[model samples]
Target: MYLTPSMAKLVHEFNKLPGIGPKTAQRLAFHILKISATEARVLASAIIEVKDRITNCPICYNITEDSPCSICKDTTRDHGLICVVEQPSDIIAMEKTRVYKGDYHVLQGAISPLDGIRPDNLRINELLMRIQQEKVKEIIIATDSDVEGEATALYLERLLRTMVARVSRIAHGIPIGSNIEYTDEVTLSKALESRRIL
Candidate 1:
């Protein structure tokens, strides 16, 4: 039987999300259909609220309700050393380890020339500006161990060589081609502790 218009539409929308296949999308759409109208409304409202209320932290480029973000505002965090990651999710993962006391800078994306993403496309310039303006002493590149991430970190290392701040790369305890978010807490903590100078 042909699917109804609304069901088809919902499935299409769900399919647009990352890693959600057509089968999973259909399952979710049907699941939503079975839920109470109030619950569905709550889910929809939650999604809308995030879009309307949450924003990128201007200082670190992480997602937050505030422009500066909690990490940037926290007095206890080390302002002299900054951990640089490719995305906001990576920052969240690192924070979960609770071993990192330094502030962070989300590069927003990695350099992938094959995909047309370049240094100019990322927040690299913003990082450089922050290092200079804040007199940052060290930068730990915690980007993913994938090819694109490696390329991005190398590019940053080269650009930061002449700068006063010491540049370092996060340890390779994380599997090659794996993102930080997937790494375990112990591994992440060790990576932070064993970070090597570039």
Candidate 2:
């Protein structure tokens, strides 16, 4: 069965998304075609709304509608302690737990030489600036347990040794090769509780 030009285009666009294959994209396009026009409009509008409203928090670089974001602005949170993470999505995962009430700083991405992503490509400079500006007592390196995450953690540890009072790494409750995004709230909370000094 030959697909029309518009359907083929939609499939191609969906295929560009992470984890979406050509077959899945085609199936998704067909599903979209079967959905009501009003439903499609709602989906399209939601996508547009996110693009229009969501912007990076200037302080932590987390995705937010406001400048500094609620976490950064919340006085109830520990201002001296900051949790460092690779992506904004990891913040959502961490928040599911009862532990960890400190603020967060999103690195945006990890350092991967093979991927041509260096420390400069992340928010390391911004983090350093923040540390200098604030009385940051400690920084928890909450990058994933993968090789890239480990390398990034080591690099950050070395870089942040003298800059801050202390630096820590989240514990091994999260299995190697497993991402924090998929980790359960219990495991994530335990990991934070058992974090080791770096």
Candidate 3:
């Protein structure tokens, strides 16, 4: 069956999003059609507004409508400690925990040789500059536990060792409620390796 040209275009656009298959795109287009015109307009306006207004913070590269994001402007956060992450979303996740009371450095992307993403493609130079200029005392590598993340963490470790700060990797282990049977081998190994007597 042939969809109307506009509806077909909407489905195609939705399909371009990450993890959105053709079927899912079609479903989303139809769902949007079912919504009130005002609500749909609001959604479209929000998307446009974000693309139009959002800009990366100059200091940390986190996405925000302002030059320096609210986090950077906040005086209570520990500027001496920086948590390095692979993406802006990862910073959001860490902030949601409300336990990390420090600044952040968003790499924007990871170094994945398979995808031709190298160190130059990320914000590594900015991080090093920040460390040197700010006299940062601690760096927490909060990159993912995957191969790329691990490689980035190791690279940062060596780089920061020569600086005036202590560097540490975030500990990995099992989730609070996850069962041992469902846990991955890497997590199990890390948990055992970082085990504490307490």
Candidate 4:
């Protein structure tokens, strides 16, 4: 099917989004065309609003509309404990659990040499500066369980171990309701390694 120039432009812009393929982008573009001008304005305004207002927290680098994010401003939480993650989105996942009452640091991305992302490309210096300036007692590595996540965690560990704080990685293993028999080798290995005395 041949798209008009306008439709093609819309599809092209949508295709630039992560996880959006040509077909999906085309579908989304068609959906946009179906919506009312008011709805389109609302959607477009939302995107623009986020880009204009959201900024990284000065202390932790989490996305925020305020100067520092609420988590960073909350002095009741443990300022000395920091949970490190790849992105600000990860902080949302951690917050949903309500188990951690500590501060956070967003690395913004993981270490992926293939993508040309290195330690210097991340907010690592900021993290180290936070450790030195604050009386931090622990640094938790909560990156994803991928190869890049592992590399980033290892790199952070080596640097953090020399600090006065305890450095630890979040355990990776089988999820709830999953069968051990069907588990992959890496998952099984991690599960076994993370086991504690009953």
Candidate 5:
């Protein structure tokens, strides 16, 4: 299929994004072509605006328009507890729960030796600095359940034990509504391990 030069270029750009296959990129490019010029310009402008305005928070490494980010500046949140996560998106997921009212430290990426991501590649040093400077009493490792995330969490837990008063990993279990019979062995094991007395 010979797409117009402009459409081909747009598809190529879209394909550069993670998880966007060539077919999906072509579809997106065609969809963009169908949209009005003004609407397309608005979309383009929004992308440019995010690139121009967003910067990592100085304290937590979360993406924000401001230096410290709103969470770091908030006086009502718990300053003595810091939840560690692999990315800024993780912070968003945690915040959506509305239960945790603590500070965060975005590691920016998890430890994955196979992918060449190491402790130095992330914001681990910055997190350590924050722990030393701030009155952080508890450090919660909230990395994902994958191999890299688990490795990152374990590494952080060990490193933070002597530094912080308490270091704990977030409990991994079967999701709330999921059926026990359908749950995988690892998830079942984790759920059992994290079972509460209540």
Candidate 6:
């Protein structure tokens, strides 16, 4: 199967993206080819614009167009309460809930010995610095319920126990509307352990 130089280049670029298989890359390349030149240019420009404008917030390490990010800047939000997460995407998920009214601290990544990620690699020191500087009353570990997320949360809890007034982990369990029969063993156990009295 021979592809033109330009088409091959496009396919290669698309394949570089995570979870994009060769067939999907080829499909994307063909879709790009089918689109008008103006639309293609717009797509290219949007990518370039994001690369040029987007950057991490210095305080919380969340991806943003500004340095501090809007969340860090907002005085109306509860700066005393900090919800710490492993990635910027997790912050988006939390925001979608719309019930939380506090600040966030993105650790950039979780500790995973298999992946060579350690405490030094994450923003742990920065979090400690924020605790010392800011009048934070509570620290909520909002990492994923996976092994790496648990490890990172435990490490943070141990480090922050004496420093902050309260340290807690976000409850992990089967999601709302999910069937018990469909849920995994660990999820069911966690749900049972975290159960509350109505």
Candidate 1: tens digits of C-alpha lDDT, residues 40-103: 9999999999999988888899999987899999999899989999989898799999999999
Q: Which 10 successive residues of model 6 have the least lDDT summed?
A: 169-178
CA RMSD of all predictions? 5.7, 5.7, 1.3, 1.4, 1.1, 1.0
State each candidate's clash count.
0, 0, 0, 0, 0, 0
How close is every model to the real structure, measured as TM-score? 0.86, 0.86, 0.95, 0.94, 0.96, 0.96
- Give the candidate number with the greatest TM-score: 6
Q: Write down the lDDT that model 2 would get.
A: 0.93
Which should have the higher TM-score, number 1 or number 3?
3
lDDT of 5 by residue, 26-145 (tens): 999989989999999999999999999999999999999987899999999999999999889899899999999999999989999898998999999999999889999999999998
* Model 4: how far residue 176 lies from native, Å: 1.9
**Which sequence of candidate numbers ranks them by lDDT, best first?**
6, 4, 2, 5, 3, 1
Candidate 2 residue runs with Cα over 4 Å from true position: 174-198
Candidate 2 clashes: the total is 0
Between prediction 1 and prediction 4, the one with superior lDDT is 4
Deviating ranges (above 4 Å) for candidate 6: none
Candidate with more favorable, higher TM-score: 1 or 2: 1
Where does model 5 exceed 4 Å of error? Answer: none
Q: After superposition on all CA atoms, how large is the RMSD of candidate 3? A: 1.3
Per-residue C-alpha lDDT of model 6 across residues 80-182, encoded as one tens digit per residue: 9999999999999999999999999999999999999999999999999999999999999999878899999999999999999999999988989989999
